[model samples]
Target chain A: MSSNFRLQITNLLIGMCRGTPGLTAELRELGYREQWITSGFPRDVAGRSHPVMVLASRETRHSLFVEVAPGPRIDSDRLLQYTGTTAVELRRGTNLSREQTETYGIAVFGLTEHRDTLRESIEESGVRAALLLCDAEGIRLDVNPFMQAALANIFRPLLPISWAGVPRWIPFDHESGPADIAAAVVPDVVARLLAGETRIDIAEVCREQVLWKLTTEAGKKRLRASVRGALAEAAGREMRKYFSVRGRFVEAATTSSDDGVPLEHRILRIVSRRQVQLLTRLGGDDRNAEDR
Target chain B: MIARSRHHLHDYLQGRMTGTSAGGTAEQPPPGDTEPIKTYLVEVRGNGVAGRDPDFSVVKTLRALVSEPYLKAGFPARVHPARERGLVTIEGRYRGGTPVSMYADCRDPRHWLIHTLAPGRTADWAIGRMAAVGTRLSRVSMPGQLLEKLAGLGLLEGLILSHDRRQFDEGGGYGAEGFMSMQLWGGQSGRILSMMSRERSLSDSVSLSRVHVRYWPDEDDRAASCLAEIDRDGRMVTRGTSYEGHLHLVKVFRRLYTRQIENLESHFRVRADGDAGKLVGRCLTIRPARPIGNSARFCDIAFSGTPPFRLWGVPAQTSGSFTRVRALDLDVGGALDCEVTPEFLRVFLLSGTSANSVVRFLTNLQHYFHSGVRLLDQDGQDVLEL
Candidate 1:
């Protein structure tokens, strides 16, 4: 997966949970810090390490580990090695039990077929766990109403940021996984969460946010520059078509005419060496006289 | 008696044969024969290869020389450009219908020819005028002394005394009293010095104006002057006059005062008021209105505003008739009434409010309108669609 795509997903997640008090507190209690680093090797006081991947956490504990690889798979050994936490659990095809959620906080696995089951378990337990789910190119899974409600509460309203191009709103009824869900629901959730009212429709909020971003100056400049650049490039190419190099001289064929003059006669005339010398001398004389 | 009669007939016949009136009457002297018999003469001048006929390359120069003088003298001269390497003819009539023909060498300056195509004192006077013009041209070609002489004659409006840095005011003490004094410096790098009232301080016994303008010729050989207006707090208030603005003022003065010393004296005053209405009109008419945001409002007159906000309000009237536009800031509750007259557009801000917010709103309104943004009317309907 591309880093930009990964970053976008990460940002969506952060934006959704950043302003939600309950979600932030819950994550904090569960040891999920903001912008937490997950690395195989560690270094000095700054917690810098090689082969590091960042996840939002609380203190030294992480509540989420987002994986955006092509295939949906769980490498439990690698996860355990990097995290260096024995409490980490790899839940495969089954949903987390109440006892499992209470005991283990980190879950690194695929969420394709287990979305409904997981949603049910989360609703039953009422405990938010650090959930990392891989559903790359997986079939659309149903989102339970309970999980939906939880997400709606956790997400915060978002202000328009510098996003170029017009917003493309995904169809509301279309089945989507965590990434799509985060993108669509987070902004509305954030808005509702800030407004303390859940009456606002998530779809409408999402569409409005898109419109807001499109109208921003930075967005407009980006779009205009893109269009202008394309046009200018086309014009430049057309201009170059008539220019040709011939031996020691570059000849530009006249493709335009003015004042009833024929194109042949309108070809730009080159100044001769003698004329150049004359002009130089004249210019020099004027400069010298001005100096005096 | 027969022989005497025959001699008279012979004289008559001889005069007739020579194409003269009978008995030499055609060549007879003027009625006042005692008066000096003056012959009217006119000189046609040209420049380029002194003795060669003007050709295609030198036609423009010869044509200019031949016709410019007559045109300057307020006569309509018809010029015939040389078809071949020969003479170019300029024919015109003097103010009193005295015909004149100036034949100029197409290839040479020295071979210019002139002829008085009519006979009379009027024709002679016209010829003399042409001669005087030639003399003036020659004098102009001499040193700067001629210009000084012309200035003395009140023909040159702006003649600065280089030594004393003072203008030669033709009307010695004209426009002397005022809150300001103006001195026009004349030279290659012409300067116009405007000394006006400076801000007075507690330490100073008397308030006096100082010469803050310094004009110098720039790279383009154009005169540039900067005007610094300082406030009471000793801070520069104005943007310091632009070179173009100085050039424009100079041009206006030149136009108004050309060859008229009295008008020059009365008009180019440095008083505080200084006939500002007329000056504003001239300035507005000459320069294109400055683009203020996107608003259709255009202003050329410079008016004072509160500190940090100079010329904030623009009084713009539509091109045709008088329509008073009241610009109300929806957010700030500030209003400015724009009165449009046939001569000018003037904006007046309502009292009891700071103009800063209102000015900003107006500027933004202009921008929005210019950018094709639709603005909502009082009824919240999209009325401004342009």
Candidate 2:
């Protein structure tokens, strides 16, 4: 990518989220200040009054993010002040005067995804930290430090995780959850499809699906099971496609059943099997695989 | 990786400039102390490695001070290289039980604090921490490169880290030796702790938060730094010197290192390497002084060779210094003129005499502790009781 793109990505992922409220003092002691960060302001900065980032001297380790979302275009007046930022107050009736309306959404995912990113990164580069574009286009996965690809590329010879953690890629609703949000406007999805109205407002649909999925344990289980089955089927299709290469192959001198199998078998046995196993374990538990 | 890490380090050093969030000041020097003492309050929690890159990690910490009002050049007594030179020496199992290592001459302690983390579990853990702070580091260096460079230099080992600048001949010089430790930081709260070189460039003014350091160490790790001066073999290696084999690496204490600097109260925490039961290094802080007697010269020695030190089978260079060796004495926090005399070095370095263990022996003696100045008697045994 271009240098600016790389810089922006790096900053977005690492800055703005340097410290948790309680952990600021500890981070500062190590010489990393909050000023180095260019973006990713926390929801409630502990010290400031206007969501502005606190500048740390160069001797500091943790970077300073002026505003969690210090994008030249983004106005962060009301999103929320994080450890280094001040909160912005908004007047109810007044229009978002240029500066106040720039509140970009900067939600930290997982538990304290914001707390320890820098400390961990300094000790090891294998950790993953991501800053993504969170909008209706299915939530741009953005730059994720936690993923295998980036970690492997950055810190060669992937180091094992220090803690036992589930290998989870960023959760992406590629299909935009279910066709449920528009169901309110039109109860039957099939009827809407037949009536030539197929575009669904993904944001609304995902919200409804999330609510429905959270309604009861059984409902969530059912949803998980169907997802698992669908994932398994898709994986199977991929496996077949990989193995069924159209090119011809020369006969091997030592023809053997186990050793002679095409490369695809080895690929499936090693790589795809992992995908299938993970899907079975998670999908089955998360959704009602039996019911599906 | 070094470049990227350097970029982040440079940024961090800069960030240290604006360190105003510390909850309180560091521990103050005892009352009646003539000079102020600046302690770097650091806390370390992991077992990763911090490199000895003179150009990057080492210098960044000191260079960050350049932005401050402190004037680095034309330092008063001791003459140092343009770069804040440093040498790492381990006193394994010799630090009187503290597995403490010394990165001598470090003016800034926080940078040194980050370098003390040991190796292993570093790739994931260390890198993750850097990325979190938006830090990019340089690529890892390998042994062949180290060896080639060593061969060219007519040195011994093939391992030359990017930072090692020493030539490994009969006597090693001030350079990067492969036998160095890694730097790291870890914890639930994700606090930082590290060990840096003892040698650093001084700032006109020191960071207040960096002056006092404290940490609730892991008990075992506590012993990691609790060193024993005398080893089991009692071999006269460089127990306190970073370069143990060589007899040339020296720091002649012209005058007791008595700079009356301030003690900006700051607390710190750190982790020690797991190689317990082994000695590491030792550290002692000097209260800033109101200039003391001139010609008060002393020299520290070391050895970085075999037959003397092969503790873990992986030969390590002996590094560390004699504890509390008085370097200077001046009335700090005061406004007054000072004087020096030729008799200062004469009596300080003289052999013992009767009536009094001539206190003058101090000019060259590296004392275990400092209590003003004293002349010693003949045989260099008893104090002159002057």
Best by lDDT: 1
For model 2 the local lDDT of residue B290 reads: 20
Please give the fraction of native interface contacts (Cα pairs under 8 Å between A and B) kept by each candidate: 0.00, 0.00
lDDT of candidate 1?
Answer: 0.28
Candidate 2 residue-wise lDDT, B165-229, digit = tens: 12221245543331232222122111211112212321111111101111112334432111111
Tens digit per residue, CA lDDT, model 1, A143-189:
32113222223322322221111011211112122222222232222
lDDT tens readout by residue for model 1, B1-386: 01123234234323322334454456542222212111211112224544654454345653454355654475555655544454445566556354454443322232222322233343344434444322211100101211222223211223222111011112332433211223343332122211111222211111211112233324354333333221111111111224333233223322222223222123221111211111100000110022232123222222112211122222222223332333332222233444333333333333312232222322222221111112222122321121
Highest TM-score: give the candidate number: 1
What TM-score, computed on C-alpha atoms, does each candidate reach?
A: 0.19, 0.16
**Second chain of candidate 1: TM-score?**
0.21
Query: Against the unseen true structure, what C-alpha lDDT does each candidate score?
Result: 0.28, 0.21
Q: Flag regions of model 1 displaced more than 4 Å.
A: A1-5, A17-33, A36-63, A86-104, A107-292, B1-386
